[model samples]
Target: MRSKQEYMEKAEELIYKTYNRFPVVFDHGDGVFLYDTDGKEYLDFAAGIAVMGLGYHDKEFDDALKSQVEKLLHTSNLFYNVPAVEAGELILKASDMDKVFFTNSGTEAIEGALKIARRYAYNKDKSHDHEIIAMNHSFHGRSLGALSVTGNDHYQEPFKPLIPGIRFAEYNDLDSVKALMNDRTCAVIMETIQGEGGIYPATEEFLKGVRKLCDEHDALLILDEIQCGMGRTGTMFAWQKYGVKPDVMTAAKALGNGVPIGAFLAHGKAATAMSPGDHGTTYGGNPFVTAAAAKVLELFEKRKIVDHVKEVGDYLWEQTEALSQKYKIITAHRGLGLIQGLELSVPAAPLVKDALLNERLVIISAGANVIRFVPPLIISREHVDAMLIKLETVLKKHS
Candidate 1:
């Protein structure tokens, strides 16, 4: 087997320099832990950026994927497939949405939702351009259309002349959203809990007010649940906790556990926006991917994953709050369920690196100073306690 250094050198030579990767090369994962090439074990708190909800090396997830591989893989959109159909049904039932359009990734899901909102407005009247209201410090995706809606200037500036007709509003600020709405506004999109920007969950009052504004302005409410949905926040969808339903919602990441799959769901009038050939994907919702997604949904119910998350998440937060009190570098901590963050007085990149190299704990940073903890839904309190010990050790060394 190749050494980690050799693999890292090859990756730097062949792959795009898109990510500032860690030094370790992961070999495999089981439950909430990952093993490196040298067989060093590290507890995984990032969960592949909140995608591996079922954790790693689960028998059920593995069996479902292998079963689909033996039966069929791709049939294209021209033919009907049982796995895709079942997955769609599950999504609809879970979201209470009328229609579902599957995509290959979260960004594509956002793109599809944006298209549906625009087409719905065009179906009404195409006299003028329709605008979408997105939130400041929000992250939708990297695609052109999704990037246009993302409110971060750091991600948007380099990709100039992106899709126009998109406006930005302050997150959790209902008045900012209301001010952006007008006759030309077709949709208002945001993450129920802002992920990459920081672990900031929207207030119930703010979401309810935004929903009312969307209704009054004839704009569809779109929730980007790519990072926070699928039981990451102790709910099937984060919006459900606020008692607000978006006209459209995008989901991915944990939707398929580790398989590549995404979906955009629409309700009521937004459901009928796209007709026959308005939009489509060649490999979206293929049997292989949808089978994994279907199995994930089933496992979520059978394991009572949402309830598990609520329990472990509460314990994790309480520990984190205590850590904040102990460590002077920790300024604040915030989040819901497994999606939580610890804001530091200093830049968090160094701390994240230290955690991996010194403490053998895997985690990621949100924005500049927040250490985001998005562990798998199946993590127990024991895992949380282990992580806290390692984290505290690292913080003390730094202090």
Candidate 2:
């Protein structure tokens, strides 16, 4: 086998330079640890950006994938498959939504949700120009349609002339959203808990107010739970905690436990908007991906992953809070369940790099100053203790 440097060099020559990735090349992973090409083990706190809810090398997930591969991979959306049906039913039941449209990724789910909102409005009144209100500092996805509503100017500036009629409002600020809402507004989209903007959970008041505003205006409420959904926030869906139901919601990440699958869910009126031929995908909801997704839901049911996340998440937050109290550099921290963030007085990039290279810990930064921790839902107190030890060492060195 080639050395780590050799593999990285080959990748540099062939792959597009979209990500400023770490130097080490990961070979494989098991549970909460990943092994580099050189066989160096590193504790995984990022969890593939909150996608690997069950961790790596899970026997049940692996066996399900293998069985699906032997039976069928792709038969297109034109036909019905058992896994697809089962996965769809599971998602609807878990989400408390009436209908589901599975896509290949989170971005596609956002795209489909956007289309459904627009079409729903257009079908009602063709003459009115539909407007979508999104939150500032929120991230939906990288695709053009998904990118259009993303609130980051840095990400949207380069790709000018994006889809029109999408406006941005301040997150967690109810008045800002109300100020922008009008008769032309067809939908209001936001993350139930902001992820890339930093792990900021929406206030109960703000979410309830938004829901009321949408109801008054007869506009759809689209919650982008792509990053915070699927038991990441100690619930099957994050919105459940807020006592508000969205007309539409997008979910992915932990939905497949690392398999590439996403979905946009709708309820009541929003659910019936997309008729036949309104929207479709070629390889979406195929047997292979849906089989993996179905298995993930099954494991969640058997393992009671939501309850586990709640207990473990409280422990992790307690540890992180103690760290903040001990170190002045850790200015603040906020989160719910496994998706948490620590805001630093200094930039977090160097610290993240140091943790990976020196402490052999895998973590990521959010919005420059916030260090994000999105570990697998299955991690134990021992795992949290191990991560905190290394993390404290890194902080001490920096201090």
Per-residue accuracy of model 2 over 1-399 as CA lDDT, tens digit each: 999999999999999999888899999999999999889999999999999999999998999999999999999988999999999988899988999998999999999999889988989888458899999999999999999999998999999889999988999999999999999999999999999998999999999999999999989999999999989989989999888999999999998888999999999999999889999999899999999999999999899999999999999999999999999999989999999999999999999999999999999999989999999889999999999999999999887
After best superposition, candidate 1 residue 292: deviation in angstroms? 0.2
**Model 1 bad stretches (over 4 Å):** none
Q: lDDT for every model?
A: 0.93, 0.94
Model 1 TM-score is 0.99
Worst ten in a row by lDDT for model 1: 123-132
Superposed Cα RMSD, model 1: 0.8
lDDT of 1 by residue, 1-399 (tens): 899999999999999999999999999999899999999999999999999999999998999999899999999999999999999998899899999988999999999999999998999987558899999999999999999999999999999899989999999988888788899999999999999998999999999999999888888999999999999888899998888999999999999999999999999999998999999999999999999999999899899999999899899999999999998999889999999999988899999999999889999999999999999899998999999999999899777
User: Where does model 2 exceed 4 Å of error?
Assistant: none
> Which candidate has the highest lDDT of all?
2
